[model samples]
Target: MAAMIGGAKPADAGAIAALNRAAFGGEDEVGIVERLRGDGLVAVELVAEQGGAIIGHILLSWLPTIMDGRAMKALALAQMAVQPGHQKQGIGGGLIAAALDQARAVGAEAVIVLGHPDYYPRFGFSAALAGNLASPFSGEAFMALELVPGALAGRQGSVSYPAAFGL
Candidate 1:
């Protein structure tokens, strides 16, 4: 499949919400994503398109953390979803890569994701807990990646994602 990864356009909102609902097994995530977009908190919102149709979506939002008494921009990878028929076809991966690239381009210090450990680690994610970072929920599902050398150095604190996450 030939897929193009690009930033979300205004026209893509409905399609993106549909993909999110289908991929996440509900509509709750759709609202959260929309809210994030409206609030200008989405650092990067990427979509995977094939043949002029959107098949996958991913969102990275501004998650702030106070470490060493300083506030820093922490990229929060959330709501990654590929259409049911498009799963395992690399659309999800493409979306993630695009989002990460955008984050790096903008000089984000670190990225955090609450996702499947097996899948995210392939993209350089590691257990945030090991680095003294904690989430509202406990487990290896919460992970982090430092985008710059020593970006996470001496940083130890809890992550605070947007309230829309309900966490």
Candidate 2:
């Protein structure tokens, strides 16, 4: 069966929240998403649907990072989740790929994600510490991928996600 991937509409509010809760095992991330949405920092929220049911979701938000004494627009990939029944079917991968494409279309230089090292590497993410980037939590969980040529070249700094992320 083919899955349909697209940006989430306002009408998808409940489905998005439910996807998050199932993915992360709680409502905390759902609240963070709601806050980001209300604060106008959500660049894009994507959902994957199969058989008329939402099964996956991903969120991209503005993350400010300084490189060479200048600030640049960075995208933070967060809240990626797939419904329990849909796990390991590439739904999450499709959602992430779509979100990254959207980010690139908007001219975001780089993208950062806090996720499993093994999983994100497939998407071209590597240890951000090599580029002098670190997250509020730790260096290991932070990863980055340059979407444009030399986007991460000479970039170094702490990443600041939207305040709604509570990072």
Candidate 3:
């Protein structure tokens, strides 16, 4: 409740990386984010700020998807992290909402994510929606949301994540 979600600035990179390290207890996420930027795959990057400090971060990147033999415009909710001290305070949800809004604003038709099934569904992410899409990740953890109505309907094919994900 104390944090406001907004787009991340270049100057906030170090803080974002540090927050990712603390949230995930490792450097893998941080590396993925950096590589996303370097590869020009970044679609949206949002941060949660409270008292002028970055408390959370979320990144969405271009996801290469082929559906029904045609390419579709999609974004991937690549990584999201809330500072350990800031978890469970609704910051993560806020980031997801805001990031999705931004993704839509940027003309993305759909968004996919590999995340907790229980959590992402509240925002309309569904493994069933991603069911026909092939990816390195599958099962309930791999989900998708159609920002534009019926975007994923009757579509079938594979999704390729940016090389940064190493998946």
Candidate 4:
């Protein structure tokens, strides 16, 4: 059956964790997701379903923008996973696309990701845009995408992950 991308249902949590485990071969992301869920840090969550079964999950959580101990608002892309059998079949890409649309619709200024340097830029995420920003995951993997034109321009600060991230 063709996969459908949609907002996650409460019942999908178990399947989401399973997909994360299968995709990443670890429980770290699942634990983080649980923590973020409990802490209300999840700004967006998308899931892919095929044959009435969940197969992929993606989340965008809120991250504080910290400059000299002051806090602002931002979003962070986290814990994206597609089931092992579904990898590279466009499910992950679709989930990202849908999430970005929602983010822009919600007036998110920018979105950050600590993800594959190669894989994420296609979605308009740029390490250059995030260059001056400080974070534990800085380097090629740390990237930002402007939902508003030049959202990160002249904005230099560290990303403050919520307690759920253990940062």
TM agreement with the true structure for every prediction: 0.93, 0.94, 0.97, 0.93
| lDDT tens digits, residue span 100-139, model 3 | 9899999999999999999999999999999999889899
Q: Report the poorest 10 consecutive residues by lDDT, candidate 2.
A: 128-137
Task: Choose 1 or 2, whichever is better by lDDT.
Answer: 2
- Write the residue-wise lDDT of candidate 2 on 49-162 in tens digits: 999999999998888877777787888887799999899999988998899999988889888888898898898887753257655756556788888766677756767766
Residues 118-153 of candidate 4 have per-residue lDDT tens digits of 999999999998886787877899999888785576
The runs of at least 3 residues in candidate 3 whose Cα sits more than 4 Å from the true structure, single-residue gaps closed, are none
Q: How would you encode candidate 1's per-residue C-alpha lDDT over 1-167 as one tens digit per residue?
A: 68888888999999998888888888789988988887888988888899999998888999877666677778888879999998998888888888889999887988888789899999988885326665685578878888876666765776777887765
Candidate number that wins on lDDT, 3 or 4: 3
Could you tell me which 10 consecutive residues in candidate 1 have the lowest summed lDDT? 129-138
**Highest-scoring model, TM-score:** 3
Whole-model alpha-carbon lDDT for candidate 2:
0.83
